[model samples]
Structures are given as C-alpha cells and as structure tokens.
Target chain A: MSRIKAVDILAGGFVVLIGVLAIVESTSFDMGTSRRIGPGYFPFYVGVLMVLLGLVIAVENLWTRTASDFGWSLPPMRSPFLILAAVAAFAVMIERFGMFPSIFVAVFLGSLADTNTSIWQKLTISVAVPAVCVAIFKYGLSLNVDVIRWRP
Target chain B: MSDFASNLALGFSVAFSWQAMWYCFVGVTLGTFIGVLPGIGALAAIALLLPLTFGMEPAHALIMLAGIYYGSNYGGSTASILLNLPGTPSSAVTCIEGYPMSQQGRAGVALFMTAIASFIGSICGMLIMAIFSPPIAALAFSFSAPEFFSLMVLGMVAASTLASGSPIKGLAMIGLGLILGMVGRDLYSGLLRFSYGVDQLYEGLPLVAVALGIFGLPEVIKNAGQITGRTVEARSISFASMWPTRDDWRRSWGAMFRGTGLGSFFGALPGTGGLLASFMSYATERRVAKDPSRFGKGAIEGIAGPEAANNAAVQTAFIPTLTLGIPGDIVMAIMLGALTIHGIQPGVSVINNHPDLFWGLLVSFLFGNLMLLILNIPLIGLWVRILAIPYWVLYPFIIAFICIGVYSVSNSVVDLYVLMFFGVLGILMNILRFEPAPLVLGLILGPMLEENLRRSLTLYRGSYTVFLTRPISALFIGIAVLILAWTIYGMFRARARRRAALAAGGE
Candidate 1:
C-alpha cells in the first residue's frame, strides 16, 4: 500500500490554497519598489515560500509515512460540531440576551459534547453555571456585560 | 552588591504591598488549581486569566500573571506523580520517573522532593534573571532594524524547527500565522489588508481571541470526553511520609544544581523553554547515573533533575520576554501581549522605562515560589482530591470562561466569531499534525519582523546585502541558515534509513 495518508493531502492542499489566495489578493494592493515596498510585498513573498513548502509537504507524503496512520477518512465530528455550535450560539445571543442567557445556552450546548452526562446533570450545570458566572462577572467584577437585559 | 541590594529592596516594597500580595496569592492559588487538572495546560490557563487583569495597575497585573506562570509549574508535577498523566506539557518529563516512584509506594517522598527542587530551581532562576537582564537590555540598545529582523528570523527558524513535529509543517504553520498577522490595517499605508469588511479587526486580529481559539479551544475539542485518567491510589502524604531518606537527599542536591544550570541557560533562549529544559535534564541525569537502569524505576535523581529544570526554565523564560521583547514560547508571547494591552510597550526600554514593574515582578516570584512550596507539600491531599474532578464537569466551565474572557477583552461580539473561526482552524491544524506553537510565535512576531524588514531595506537603499554586511545581523542570519540546513539534513537521513529498512524487509 502507498504510505501517503489523507492528512498530508488535506493539509498540503489547504496550505497551497491559502498561498494562492494570498498571492491573488496582493494583486489589488500596490506593489511598490524594493526600497519602499508596499503592503503586498511582504505577503507576496510569504505566499511564494508557503507554496514551495506546501508542495514539499504534498510530494513528500507520497512515498513516506506520516507520524500516525489516520487512513482515508475525515476526522470524527461529534465534539467539534457540538463545541463549535455552543460558541456560535453564544455569539448570536450575547448582545441580544446579555451575559446570563448567553452563558446559559453556551454551557448547555457545550455540556452536550460529553455524551456521558445525564440529562439532570446537564440541566443542573446549565442553571448553576450561569448563576455563578453572573455573580462573579456582573456583580463582583462589574464587567460591562449585562446579566439579563431584554434589549432585543 | 549594594546596588543589587537596593533594587531588591525596591522589589520587596512593591511586592509586599497588600494589593500586590493579594493578587499574587490569587494568581498562584488559581494557577495551582488549573495546573493540577489533567487535559488542560498552563498556556490555556494564562489566557483565561489575562482579561481579569485588565483593570489593575500594570505592575500588579503582571505580578499576578507571572505568579500563575511559575506556580503552575509547581502544581504540574502532582498529576505526573500520583497518576501517570502529565497535567502540563513541561511536566510530561516528570512522568518518566515520577509515576514509577508513586507506583513503588513512595509518592509522598516524590512530592516533597519535587517541591524542594522546584523551590531551589525557581529561586536560582530568579537570581539569574536579575543579574543577566540589565546587561542584555543594554546590549539590545545597539540593535537597529536589520538586526531585529535577523534576530526575529533566527527566533522563528529555531522555534519551528526544534519543536516537535514535521519541520515542513511547522514552517507552513508559521507562514499561515504571518498571513493571519497581516489581517488588519496596514500601519504605514493606512489601508486595510485582509479584514474583508470586518470593522472590529481594524487594529489587528485580537491576540486573546486567536490565542484562545488556537491553543485553548483545540485542547478542549481533542480531549473533551476522553480524559478519564488512571485512578490515583489514595496516598496519604503526611509530614513523616514526605521526608526523603538520607540517601535520597544525597542523590538529589547534585542533580538539582546541575538541572538548574541547564534550565537557566535554555530558558533565556528566545524560542526554547521549560519543555526542552526538562527533557534535556532527564537525558543528562540518565547519562550521569552510576547505574542507568535505576532511571524510569523510581530513581530520586530522575524526579529531582527534571522538576528543578522545568521550574528554573519557567523563571528564566521571562528574561528574553521582559528584556528583548522576544518570547521564549507561547506563554511568554501571551505575557508580552498582556503588557501591550496594559499600555506598556515591551522592548529593551521596558526595564529602563519601568524598573518598579520589573523589580516588583521579581520579588513577587520569591513570594509566589514560597507560596507554592507551602501549597504543594502540606496541601498535597487537597490536590489529589482535585485531580478526581471529572472531565465532564470541567470542560463546560472552560468553554464558558473562554467565551466570557474573549468577550471581556473588548466587549465586542465579533471576537466571539473570531474565536469560532480559529477554533475550527485549530481543529483542522491538529488533525493535519501541525504544531500550533510556531504559528502563534509567527503571529506575535509578524508585525515587528515586517516593519523591520521594510525599514532596513529603505535605510540601506534596498541593498539585500545589508543583512549580511551588518555583523550582528549576519551572525543571526547565519545561525538561522545553519539550523535550516541541520533540520533538512536530519530529515533526509531519517528518510534514507527508513527506506533501507523497508528494502531489507522485502517490501
């Protein structure tokens, strides 16, 4: 079997795409002279180096083994999905509902990432965490965030 | 000697204040609690606490933050000794001997000795920092744009190459970080570079958000439900149980001093830090042992050397950050960002501009180490119980804290989105086997490097040879080149050997 792993291809392709994006974007910015180089100059050069390095990573993986054998599949997404959703939920809610509700929803969604927890445990945590947080951040620290404003 | 005495007096005066002492106590206590937990690390803990320090005086804020950094080192060995898990990355070396010692039913002695060694290491490292920083700061005054640029290059190269993982991947991550660093308004041209209509990003990528997203969230994502470490046996570590035998005492002192020496040297380097020092100390101890077989089998020197080494490295790691404004690692980089957020510019001028701040931090280390020594020895039982706090209970609080902390940075919701973006990016990078340390370093150093490069080119009329013509700049670039060559050569040799092995196996 070929030693090349899915990780190397994904990583290399993504990096090269970033390099191309950088190089293409620099075209809109002014590329001044070497003595008075513009914003584009540094990134453009960095993009070139990135492309070279990315190519090395992609090609080098073809005949050599990676540190771990991840095989040919995407990584599992259970934790990443739940955890990211938790953060996203907070971002959407924080300004509208303020700190307490936002933290409440965020903690609830985050607690779901660990499937080992019972429903009661999650509920208790969802309630208790926000209370403590409100007490600490809003009451004690006097952070600018609101606890339960209904601005929306 | 008198000058040193007076400076220390100034330090004590600042540190001995009620407010400073209170914050310092809070920081170390919080630091120990965070460090004793498995699946979290000192880097994430520091980032989590950074926002809370925003309202304080810069000196008090830094004193607390520095307390967290070193106090965590003292608490880090707890998990390594009691369970086989390393609570912090630098303490991973402690696992080699520490776990074995615990298995042999000598857990208390191991804990006690580590506290003693860590105390010695920290005190010695602080002294070294006091003696060396002024001279280094003075020397840095002579540096210009080219020298700074070359030194940054050297730092970047060393950081990406010497750190574990594929050197190519590490370099690629740095490239990505440099691009990320350019995501705001161009300072000289007054034009936005890569913000893409995000108004909040005009200043730059929020350092706290990116740091949390990259280092903090990724750790949570990877280890969320899986960190049920080995159940620690209830080791009742009373004062009598904690005492080392006379033979144990004999073997440890020499190793502690030697490890302190190695750690002090490595910690002052711009890119390496406690992790490398601890590992190198472990290797040195094994090499010098009368019977090398005793290592990894509860050899007292094994624990003594590395615990001392990592703690010492923690103290000296501040030297480069506080003096030259170059971080020894990601944690130091965050500390630098803290100073910047507090309106204190970090550079050679830092020491001269703010002696009270510098000396106050030094004296606080003295107090913080003593605090850790107290907390780690007599209070060993309390931490053992703390280690039992399951991962499910812990990570949700971490998520809440990360969100709140990032929001508190500017009271802006946009940073929350930035947190989400980097959180996803960090996960992808992890799956790709890319190390995040070098990228963070690159992000931190990117602006300074680009600015210096532009200035040097403009000053020397675009003569590329100016980097080579300047003596110190040339030396820095030369070291960078040598490191690059050595890494490439090492990779090739490893590849060739692997190929030969495959051929011999009739593959």
Candidate 2:
C-alpha cells in the first residue's frame, strides 16, 4: 500500500479503537442527571463521531481515487543530521548561553548550507543578532538570567 | 477637541518613552525574522518572550508583544510567496496563490505586493480601532457563557474552512483535536479523562509544545530530505521601483477594504479570531475575483486580501479581548497572562482606570505599523536570501531551538518529555493528513470551554435549554447548526460522487 493509504488505514483503525474504548470505559460510570450532560456524555459522542469519520475516511480511501502525494525520496541526509545535531547542541547549551545566544547560534550555524554566505557576514550575524537579542531581552528589559552577567 | 488633544498627547507621551520605542523595534524585528522562517509563528514568538516581558512596565511590554503579533502576520507572506513555504498558519492562504507565483518567477512582485497589502491592512485596522474601539468593546461586553459556548462551536465547525485539503479530512481533524483536547483532567470533578495513568498528561498538553511538535517538526521532517533548488524557466518580474503601480493600487485597495470588513467580523468571533479572518478573506477574494481560475495560480489578489485580513484580524481581535477580559484567541490568551502579571485587569474598568495604557496601546499600534512598514519593505531582499541557507545546516538548529524553547517555558524536564511524546504524535497526525491548527486551538480553548459550560449550567439550575433560550446563544448555535449541516451535505455529495465514479469504472 502507498504511505498515504497505509496511514489512512492505521489512523482509521486507531480512531475506531479509541471510540470502542471510550464506549466500553464510559459505560461503568453513572451517566448522571439528564438535565446536565455528564462528563462522559460529550466524550462518548465525540468518540463515536471519530470512529464514524475514520471509517468513512478508510472506506473512501479504499474505494476512491485519492491522490498519492506522500512520495518517498531520500535526498542528501546531511541537513537532517546537522539539524538534529544543532537541536542537541542547543538543548545542552541553553542554560550556558541563555535563550538569546542559544537560539542565535543554533539558527546561524544551522543556516550554514548556503554557499552565498561570506565569512564576514556569517561572523557579523553570529555576533550581532545574539548580542542585540541579549541587550533587548535581558539588560534593557531587566529579565533575570545568568547567561551574560553584567555589573553596572 | 480638548479630550481628543489630551488623549493624543498622552498617547504619544506614553508611547515615545525610549525603552518602549526600543522594545517596539525589537518586537517588529523579531516578528519579521519569525515571519520569514516557515513554521515559527507569532504566537510562539510572543509566548517565548512572555517571561521576558514580566519585568517591563505593562504598557511597554504589551506594546512590544502586540507589535510582534501583528508584525509577524505582516511578514509571514514573504516566505510563503517567494519560497512556497508558509511561515505561519495564517500565511497558508498565501501559499495557494503564492507558490504558483514563485514558480512563475514573479516572487519579487508577490513579495512586494504582500508587504504593501500588509501595511495597508495594518493602517486600516488601526484606523478602525482608533475610531470604534469603545463601541466594539461595548458590544463585546454583552456576550455571556451560553453565547460564548455557541461561539466556540461556531469556531469548531469553521475549522473546515481553514484553507485545508479535504473538507472531510478537515472536519475529522477537528474531531481528533477535540478528543486530544479532552485528554487531560476533567475540570468540574478534577477526575482524569484520557490520561491512561501517565502523570505527563495530567495538566493537559501545553499549547507551545503541541504547536511546535505538530506544525513545526513535521514541516522540518518533510523539508529535511527535499532539495530546494529553484528552477524557474519564466523570467523574474521586478517592479521599476518600490512603489506599486496605479493598477496594483486599484486592485489591492478593493481587497484591503473587503479584507477589513471580513477581518473585523471574524476577529470578533470568539474562538478562531484571526485564523478565520485569513481563511474568510481568501475565500471571499476567490469568490469575488474577476478570473476565479487565477487563484491558486499566482493571483496577486490572493496574497493581498488574506495578508490584509490576517493582520487586520490580529489588531481588531484585540478590541474584544482588551475590553471584555475574554480572550479572542490563543495569542490573546498569552497576552492575558502578560496583563495579569502587570497587575492590570482587562475589562470595562481598564478604560475607566488606566487611560495611559488604553490610549498608549492604541497609539503604539499606529506607531508599530509605521515601524513595520519601514522595516519590512527594505528587508524583502534580505529575507529572500534566508532561503539560500541549506537544509542540512538549518534543520538541526530549528529542531534544537524547538527543544530549547519548549524546555525553557517552565524549567521542567517533564515538559520536555511531554514535548517529545507529542512530537511523535504530531508526526503521526501529519501522516494521517490531519490539520493540527484546530487541535492546538482546541487544547487552548478546552479549559475555558469547560469552565464556562459548568458555570452556565449552575446559573440555570442544571437546565441544558438555557443555552438555546438566550437570544445571543440561540443565534450563535443556530449559525453553528447551519454551518455543520452545510458541511455534512457537502461531504455526502463528495462521497457519493466518488462512489459513482468507482461504479462507472466497473469496479
């Protein structure tokens, strides 16, 4: 099966499963005053609607001419690898550099795939955006953080 | 004359403080940056800065936050039009016509036109706010719980109109979102609904984490492996100057007017707010266009109308929020936090109490729009250059930034675990062709909805009919029912057509 169809089936199945579970689980509770719909009442209906909708989606995809948009193509993986690395680095160094430096550094080095960027421009951006962000957010606003300690 | 003069002078006095001006500049700049980058939204930007804004004076902090909110709305079209990637949910309307324009190599014209259109929209919305805020606030104050619930239902039904792929899929996604929203603690009894005994799901999902995971990470994953080399056979179109031609002005002015009209109405509609404004604008533009076929094929009207509507909606939505103390949307919800932190009660009393805040905010909006126009028009070329950055280098940083931003929100490692878990769920959501925006909207509004629904029941002596008996509530519910009926009919017809086609094929 195509990925789109595959996912549709799985999602449909999951929705159905959730609906069944909600129905089964909700039955144990006292549905309580008819004047006020119990907590389970809204959820039970929502679950039923989900299952019905999922079935419709699944059956429709099976019978209908749905477009296959999710094509599988593995382009160069360098960017993905780098992106993961940058995320890891940021997650680790956030406390050290603070939100400003951490974000600027991640966005800067993370944008390194462009052949158009000069060393000077990169250096300027790398230095400038973080500093500006720090000045504006931390010092100017008096936001408390220990990343770049300033004594005036 | 004396009152007008005093208010104007006082507004300028409050808005012109050096610190306020600097924050405005910072807010506009940050707004532009986020707008240029796909998947980073104004709401996320505002939420991240909420903590930082805690220290500044209420007016200055809110001015900056509000600037970022609308500034990003203005700039979001740059990437969508030029790069075929929407920078925010609101800008997806641009992508229908914008990506095609880029493919035709009129990316520059599209970018320029959108920027101009945004400025016009911002100016118009501000004018509206300046002239009519008190009346609008007075109207908004009349809404009660039943009316609010009806409004929320209207928003939920309208989720299908969010410029999405399939109507059934869209509605189904909304259902899914509502279910996901119900996964946390039950508001009335304090009992868990769908927690499955996991402590992480106790307080429900955070809006930022869910937004980042569902919308942000999926796009990154999709784009991570795709090559972005532009191969435009069509010659690129450039304006002789920054100024739009008289014809451009004529075409766009109508769109701006129409957008403002739609924006004002949709922005006031409690739950969806600016989201519906952008969608409604695009749909209206499509319906009204002389050549309807040109939409989704590089129509400048497509860009102009929706961009205008989105920004206008952002500004006008504040009227209801600021005056009523009820949030019009999630961004306003975060701004509510800012208000409470600054010790300001956002209600009828705000105008009675702090005239500086009310007038200053109004005037700062005018100043902020001017600053945004000056800031974005010249920076179009610089923004386009951002697309030149390679995926390998950019993707990791985006992922890392998402991680850090989510983690920093509460200084809780538990939130990180919650984020990662939802990140997986988000990827699955994408795979299932579900639009995540409504889901995020649901999660944000769920708590409020529960609280109000219960309060209304209590008020009515446990009578459910109270919702329908109230005039405003009845009207809103009536509209919601009509919308739902229309959607159901539409879905049935589409499904029947598919079945007919299948039978005709002798299957």
Candidate 3:
C-alpha cells in the first residue's frame, strides 16, 4: 500500500477551510440578480469553485502513485521560528516602544537564528543593522517614524 | 514612422531630464547590487526597495523599478559563472556552462561575452517593445467588458497552468487571491466583504505589505543562517582578460541574435517570462551548435545565448504588463502593484493617457542596459567582493528593512501585523508546494477581473452567453479552456504512466 501524501491532504483541507469561510461570509452580503452583480455574486461562485478544486486536490493525491511527487517534509523550523518571532517582535513593539527599540529587538531576534555567529557577533549586528537602517530609512528617505518615543 | 520618431523624441525628453536619469541610475545600481548577492533575488529586492519610491514622480518611480527588473538579469550571471549559484532564477541556465567555463579559467571571456550579448539583446528587445506595444495597445482598445473578462480568465488560467506546480493548486491559489481582493469595501454597494472585523482592511490589504510579506520575508527566512559567508578566493577577474577572440565574436553574435528573437517572442506572451525564454534559447543554441559536445564543457555560446535571452525577455516582459495591465509573473505583478500605488490604472489607456510615463520607461531601458554593461565590465571586482558579505550580518538588516518598509507603507502598525501574517502564510504555502507567483498575479488582477465580469453581465443584461457570443471574448475563453484541458490531460497521462511503472515493478 502506498503511503498517503500529507502535503496534498493538508493543502486540500486548508483550501477547503478557506472556501467554506468565503462562502459562509459571502452569504451575508447581498446576492443580487446576474445583471447587476452584488458584492457576493463573484465571491460566492468563486467559493463554490474553490471547494470543488480542493476536493479534487485531496482525491487526486490518494489515487496518484509516484515516488517522484514532491514528498511532504517538515522544513527546518529553527529559521522560520526565529525569523517569524523577529517580525512579530517588530510588529508588537513598533507602535508602543517606537522604531529604534522595535528594530533593535527584531534584528537581535533575527540574528539569533544564525548558529554560525557568536553572541558578540549577533549583538553587534543587531546594533549596527538598526543604526544603518535609521540612517537610510529614517534619515536618508525621511520615513515618517520617531527614532524614539513613549507611546504606551 | 513619424509618430514613432516623435514618440521617441518625447521619451528622450522625459528620460534625459536629470532627476529621472538620476533615479534610473540609482535603480540599476541597486538592482545590480542585490542581484550579485547570491541568496537575495530581484523579487525580494524590488519588494524591499518599493517603499522608497513612494515619494518620487510616477514616471521616475516606474523607471527605477523597471531598471531594477532588467539590471538584476545582468548581475545574476556573475554568481552563476564565479560560483555555481544563480543570482536570479532565469540565470540558472548560465551555471551549467558558466561554472565549467570559470573552472577552465575562461570566466572573464564568459562574463564579457554575456555582457555584450545582454546589451545587444536588450537593445533589440527594447526596439521591439517600442515598435510592437502601441499597436498591441491599439488592438486592446477594441476590447470591451466581455473581452476583458475573458482575457483575464485566459491570463489567470494560462499563468496558473504554466506556473511550476500542480495546475489545480495554482487555480486554488488564484481563488484564494480573488477572495483576498474582495476584502476591501464593495465599490457599488459599499458593503465590506471579508474585512473580518479588522477595520484596517477596508482599504484592502496594503499591496506593499502583502508583496513584501510574501516575497521578501520568506526569502530572508529561508536563507538567513543557511547560506553563510560565500567568499571569492584569490582569482580576480581583471579587465585585460575580458576581451574575446575573433572566433568567439563570430560564434556569439549569431547566438545572441537568435536568443533575443526567442526571448522577445516568449516574453511578450502572457504568463511566461525570462526563465522560460532563456531555457529555450539554451536549447536552440545546443541544437544549432556545430559540435554539441562543447555545450556542457565551457561553451561560449551557452552563456552568450541564455544571458541574451533572459535580458531580452526582461525587456519584453514589460510589453504585456504595461499594455494589458495583466502582469505575467511575480516580478511584473509587483510592478503592476507599483502602478496601482501611483493611482495609474494599467490598460490600453496607459499609453494614450500617460504617454510620457510609458515612453520614458521604454527609453530608460537603453540607459539602464548601458549602465549594466559598464557595471559588469570595469566594476566586476566590486561585485565579486560583495559575495563575501556574511549572511548573519546581512539578514538582520533585511529583516529590519522589511519591517520598516511595510510599516512606512501607510504608517499603520496594522500593516506590520498584515506583513507578519502573510510571511507565515508564505512559509506555509511554500511547504504545500503552492507557487506564490500565481497567487500574486491572481490577487493583483482580482479586482479588475471582478469589475469586468460585473460590467459584462450588466451590459449583456444578465446573459452569460454574451461571453461566448462575442468573437474576441469567445476566442480568449476558447484558449483558456484548451490550456486547462491540456494541462489536466497531461496530469492524468503522467499518473497512468506512473501506475504502469508500478505494475511492472510488482511483476
């Protein structure tokens, strides 16, 4: 027996979830006559079509037999986890803490993902990156953000 | 011909202006900068730099962005030759011959020939774009709502089908994109569709944020620690060694022209771009070579042909994008988003309404290619040195820029969250083998597609038959149907063959 491809199953299920959400949400909007397409008309049809497409993807994965098919495997979570945390840190801190602090922390977090670098190297990078960025984005380009502020 | 001359005169007038020329220079320089860096691509660079153009003139903005797009093609081959790494996807073909050529100590010759080929190809492609675009736009003027809807359908179907993944998944991504496009408030009724209680999304997902989130962040995440300091060792590429022999010139000139011809054709076609064009040119060169055995083992024609083809394709890819408002790939899709940010509706009217922007951009290609030729030859060492920059140091700056870039798009912190959300989504989609290019194309085209669909329905009094009844529209639909059927048929046939092989193995 062939092992099921988890990638296709997950992709199909994820798509189905999105389709159902679209269909469910679109039902709230007006479904007018075809002559005058309501907001939902385009989306509602798109949703139904998506649902069918999702099902096809899921079913096709089970029927097809091929070792050449791109097998699903978990990506190296270290980089993704650290990098995402960095972006999240930036998002959460950018408003409340301000630009410099937000960027410093984010860069610090992002820099930690590199095992090749030492703590001293990471800290220097975290500091230098934000300084150069402030010069470029903040000073050079005049990006409208405070270098430091206490919003909270 | 008079119209062509006068239009070109107008183009020169706009492009020669010092400020416009300055933006163009900066653009190509930066484009080459990131293009030489192994892991970072033109797409991510464009996204990262896109926000900086917000304060500029629309014409200059487009000129800069366009410069980045083509300049990267020139820079991409450097890494391919020196290292086995490709700076851009289209330049991957270069590595096959380029790395071998470098190994054989003919790296300088390969580099020089590629620059010369790229320059010729770009010039020819630009000329073709200049000559062909007006007529194409003129043809597009006759296209109405049904025709537009059909064309968009054709474009979406064609783009997804041709994209690197399962056609169904591509279609599904497009569907997701369409839903994302419907997030903003409805134009007619003013009803919000999928804002999902987040009031910030009423203006639609910020294009810059969405683009940067999808293309920019994932690339950084994937490459941050993974590809560490790649240094160019003691071998320095001096200008003295770059000159080619008489035989080299004779072999390469024909290959360059042939590659340009193939690239211009493939590039102008919807959904396809430089990657496909360059590969085609490589195959053509191999087929037409006197001794095909020379191909994989440091063939001058290999580098010359593909480099020419990719650069030529880069120039012609703008033809469909600027004329049809339907971008062919992820890069073009970002470019289309750039125009939308500047309040320019890309279509047939773009040429008629914004002649200066269109013509000036076309003219800038000449200057940009010239800039690339200079950068590639005399300044080749600078780029080689650039390869030595450590990834750990580079990626933090990249992450910082991404965050600030997304934030500065509208000064909304909410956009930051949006960026984070899509960054994760991008990673997830990457795992599922979903090609983000189709999704992006679908997202950008979604609103226009919906608008055209509604208008066609209204104009034909709710008659869906109008799509088929109209000749041009019907033709487009027919093409879309044919492509979809062909793709599905191909998939089934492959599956059947796989089954047969499995049965044989069992026996």
- What's each prediction's TM-score? 0.97, 0.77, 0.97
lDDT of 3 by residue, A81-110 (tens): 888899899888887888889999999999
Q: Ten-residue segment with the worst summed lDDT in candidate 2 chain B?
A: B230-239
Model 3 agreement with the true structure over B454-500: per-residue lDDT tens digits: 99999989999999999999999999999999997888898888788
After superposition, the stretches of candidate 2 with alpha carbons farther than 4 Å from their true spots are A1-6, A17-152, B1-14, B89-111, B130-133, B160-204, B225-240, B270-302, B319-359, B379-381, B384-387, B499-507
Best candidate per DockQ, number?
A: 3
TM-score of chain A of 1: 0.90
**lDDT of each residue in A33-123, candidate 2, tens digit only:** 5446567765677678878977876766654444454563334445444544445555555666666666566556545543355666556
What TM-score does each model's chain B reach against the true chain B?
Answer: 0.97, 0.82, 0.97
DockQ scores for all the models shown?
0.73, 0.24, 0.79
Give the per-residue lDDT of model 2 (tens digit) for B37-104: 76567776775566556568888888889888888887788777766777777888889888887777
Clashing pairs in 2: A79-B392, A83-B395, A83-B396, A87-B400, A110-B393, A110-B394
For candidate 1, give the DockQ. Answer: 0.73
| Model 2 Cα interface RMS deviation (Å) | 5.1
lDDT of 1 by residue, B184-301 (tens): 9999898888888897899999998999999899889888777754476565678898899999999999999999999998888788788889999999999999999998899999
Go through the candidates in order and give each one's C-alpha lDDT.
Answer: 0.88, 0.68, 0.86
